[model samples]
Target: MTILNNKESMRVTLKSVTVPSIPLAALLVIACSGLWFSSYWGARLALFPNQTTEIVNHLQKIIVPNTLLSEIISFFLTLLNAFLLAQINNKFTIIRTRTFLPILVFMTLMGTWNETHLANGSHISLTLFILSLFSFFSMSRNRNSSEQAFMGSFLISISSILINPLIFLIPVCWIGFGMFQSLSLKTFLASLMGGLTPWILYLALNFIINPHFNVLQALILNPNFVLDISTYSLPDLVYFALMSIIIIMGIVGLYSTAHSDAIDTRNKLNFLVFLLISLCVICFIFINQFVSFLPIIALVYALLFSHPLTLKQNNFHSILFIVFCVINLVYAVSKYILT
Candidate 1:
C-alpha cells in the first residue's frame, strides 16, 4: 500500500500489467464490493426510451437485467471505456507518466454507483464516444489514417446519437477535432457519408415495414430534456462535493504544467481537455441534465488529476491524493453501514 505514497511506483503498477488486464480485474472486484450494500442498492437505471431510436430502445431492453449479471456487464463495459481511455493517454503521451486512468474512473464511479446503478444506454454511448475519440486521436499525426479515422469516428458518433439523442452535439466537437488535425475534404466527406449510412439503412428497412415511419421526424423530434437536479439527497451532494474537489485539483495540476510542457503535447492535451469540458457542460446544461455523465468527466479528470502525482511537487499532492482516496472509500463504507 506504500505504493500509494509514491508516483513512480503507482505508475509502474498500472503500466506494467496489461496482458491479463489487472487494472480491469481490480475494478471488477471493487464494483462487486457493492454486493454487501445490495439491500440498499435500488434500481437506478437512467434510460430515456422515448428519446432513443428503435434500434437503441431494443438494446436498452436487452442490456438491462435485474439480476447481478447486469452489474457485471456494466462494470465490464466501464472497464472497456477505461482501457480505451488509457490507450489514448499513453499513445498521445497525454499524462506522460504511465498511470491507469481506469482506476481513477472507477473511483469516481464508486461515488455514483454505491447505492444504486445501471449500465444504461447513456453509459453505452460513453463507450462509443471513447471509440470515436480513439479514431480521432489515431489520425493525429498519421495522414494516411485520416479516412478510416474520420469514417470510424462518424460511424460511432452516429451510433451513439441513435442510442442517446442528446449526444447529437458531439459530432460538432468531432468536426472541430477534424479541423484541428487538418483533415482533407475527402476525409470529411467520408465522415459525413459514414454518418448518413446508418440512417439510410435504418430508413430503408423502416420504409419497407412501415411506410409512414419518417426518419427525419424521428431525428428532429426525439430528445426531451428533463432538467432537475434538486432531487439529489445529502449523500449525493457529499459524493458530488468529493468528485468536484478532485476535478478542481486535477485542473489546477494541468494548468500548472501548460506552459512547461512541449508545445505539441500541450496543445493536444489542451484540445482534449477543452473538448471533454465542453461535453460535460453540454451534458449538464442540456442533454443528461444530471450527474449521469460523471463517468465521462471522470475520465478527463483522472487524466489531468494524475499529472500532479507524476512529479514530486512537494508532499502536498501525495497528502491530498491519499486524503481524497480515504474520504471516498470511507464514504462508501459508511454509506453501506448506515443504509
Candidate 2:
C-alpha cells in the first residue's frame, strides 16, 4: 500500500520506464553489445542462401564489405520500424501512455541473442512489413485516405515478398484487415492492382535479365518451409515460452477491455491489425524466416501486454513483469558470456 501510495511507484513499472527515451537508450547499449558476442560480426550477407539471396547478393556487390553494411542498413531499418510502431501506438492509443514500448520490446527480443541481426532478407522484409502496417493503420480515420493506405500497404507487402517469399501469405492478411476496416469495393480493387503491379515489374526485370528464365518457377513455389525449433537451447526455449505466455495474456487483456466505451473505432481497428499479424506469425513460425518475424510480434506484445501492468496493482502482475525483464537480461548476459 505504501509503495502504491508513493508517486514514484507508478513510474517504477515496465510501462512507465518505456515512456522515456533514456531507458530505451540503455537498452540499445545492452542489445548492441550482445550482438557482438557471436561469430556474426563482419559476417557476409546471406550467411546462407534463400529466396532473397540474389537480391542480397546484388546489395553485397553494390554495398561493399557485406557484413557491416548489412548490419548498418538492417539496424537503421529496425529503428525506423520501431519508430513507426510507436507512431501506431500514438495514433490508436494502443498503450494508455505514449511510450516507446514497441522499440524496447523489440530490443528485448533482439537481446535474446537470436539470429535476428544477421542483416538478411528478413530484416529488409520486416522493414517493409512495418511500413505496410503504418500505411494500413492510417486507414483508420479517413475514408479519403483509404486508397493511399491500401495501395501503400500492398506495394510494401509485394516488395517484402520479392525479398522473402515466405511472407507471400501476408497480403491476404492485409486484404482481410482492409475488409475488417470497412474497405470499399474501389479500395479493394485498388489493393488487387497494387499487389499485382509488383509482379509485372518483376517479370519485366526477369525478362531483361535472362530470356530463358522460367517465369512460373520464379514466381511460384519459391518459398522454402523449414519447421524446426530443436536448434534452440534450453535458455532460448525458456525465454520463448515466457514471451509467448506474455503475448497470450496481452491479447486476452485487450479483448476483455474492448467493450469499454472509452476505446474508440481507430483503437479497435488497430487491435484487429495486431490480432491479424499475431496469427500470421504463429502460422509461419516454423520457417527459418520466423526470426525476422519476431519483432512484429514484439511490437504487438508490448502494446497488448502492457495493459495489465498499467491497470493492475497485484503482486502476481508485478512479479511477472520483473521476471520478464530479468529473464531477458540474464539470458542475454549468459548467452554473451557462454558464446
Candidate 3:
C-alpha cells in the first residue's frame, strides 16, 4: 500500500467506511482506525520484529502471532459481552453474578505480548477459545451458575496467565467488576487472589519442573521489556481522562439510583469495582514496568461497567468515547508517520 498523504488517507478511510450507523459505527470504526493508527506507532516502537521502520509492514502486522483474528473477534465479543451483561442485570435483578464476560475481557489480553516478549501460551490449546463461550452458556443448563461461572472464569483467567503471566494483573478487573455486588472482604479477596494464583502456580510449576526458568524474576520484573505500542496512545490519554469522568458519573448515577438508604449490594459492588480499577491505574502509573496493560484493562472495564443509560444517553457517551478514540488514533498516527 502506498503512503498516501494524510488528506488522501483520511479520504480513503471515509470512502471505505461510509455507512448509515456512522454514529454507532464510530466505535468499531475507531477500532479499525486504531489498527490503522497503530501502523504509525508500530514503526516507531519498532521493537518487536526488532528491526528498521516499515509503515505498511507494521499495518500488515495487525493480527498478533498465534491469534490470527483475535483482535477483530475480541472487539466484537467485547460488544456482545457488554450488551448481554446489561440485559442480565435487568432480568436477573442480580448484578453480582460475576458472569464470564468480564473475565473474557481480561483473558483476551493473552493474545497480547509479554515482558520477555514471549507469546505466553494459553492452558487449553488454540481450539478452546471458542469453547470458553460454550462453557459459559453450558453452565446455565443445570442452573448452578455462581460458583460454576466464577470457577470457569477462574480457570480461564488461569489459562490466560499461563499464556502470559502479566495477565494475572487483569483480575484487578475482576476486583473492580466484583465491586458492584456484595463487597465482602472475603469474597473480594477471593477474587483478587484467584486472579493472581495462576501465575503463582505457574511459577511453582516452573520452579519445580525447570528449576532455573527465573520464574520469580521474570514474573516480578522484565529488564528488557519494551512498551507494546499496540497498547497505548497519546490521544487515548484523553479518553482515559474521560473514562475517569465516566467513572465519576457512574458513581453519581449509582448513588442517585441507590437513593442513599442503607447502601445496597449493587452500590457496594460498584464502589469496589471503581476503587479497584483506580488502584490498578495508580499502581501502573508509578510502575509502568510491571503492568503496561493496565490501561487496556482499566479502559475496557470503564467501557463495560459504566452506568446504564438510555439509547440517547448511551449514544451521547459513545460519541464522547469515539471522539477520544479518534484523537488517540490521530496522535498515534502522527507519532508513527512523523518519526
Estimate every model's Cα lDDT from 0 to 1.
0.58, 0.57, 0.39
| TM-scores of all predicted structures | 0.75, 0.76, 0.46
The regions of model 3 sitting more than 4 angstroms off are 1-153, 156-201, 213-265, 268-276, 294-326, 329-333
Q: Which is the winner by lDDT between candidate 2 and candidate 3?
A: 2
lDDT by residue (59-104, candidate 3, tens digit) is 3366453242533444454344344444543443323332322322
1 or 3, greater by lDDT: 1
Model 1: per-residue Cα lDDT over 148-247, one tens digit each: 6556756565655555443454465455555456466666666667676766677788889999898676665333366556855576678669867776
Minimum summed lDDT over a 10-residue window in model 3 is located at 116-125
The model with the greatest TM-score is 2
Off by over 4 Å in 2: 1-12, 21-53, 60-66, 141-146, 166-171, 174-180, 222-226, 261-286, 310-315, 334-338
- Clash pairs (backbone) in predicted model 2: none
Against the true structure, candidate 2 has what lDDT?
A: 0.57
lDDT, residue 228, model 3: 60
Candidate 2 local lDDT, 1-339, one digit each (tens): 113446544433444454556766676545654553332453312233333435666765665433655556656766676677777667656555555545566656653534555545565666666666666655654445657655665656565544545335455545545554546666656666667777778778878989997777665534345556786678777877877786666566556655652435435545555555654655454354455455555555665666555555455555666777787777666665656
Show pairs that collide, candidate 1.
none
- Model 1's alpha-carbon lDDT is 0.58
RMSD of each: 5.2, 4.5, 11.3
Which parts of model 1 are misplaced by more than 4 Å?
Answer: 1-52, 107-111, 114-117, 141-145, 169-187, 220-229, 287-292, 330-339
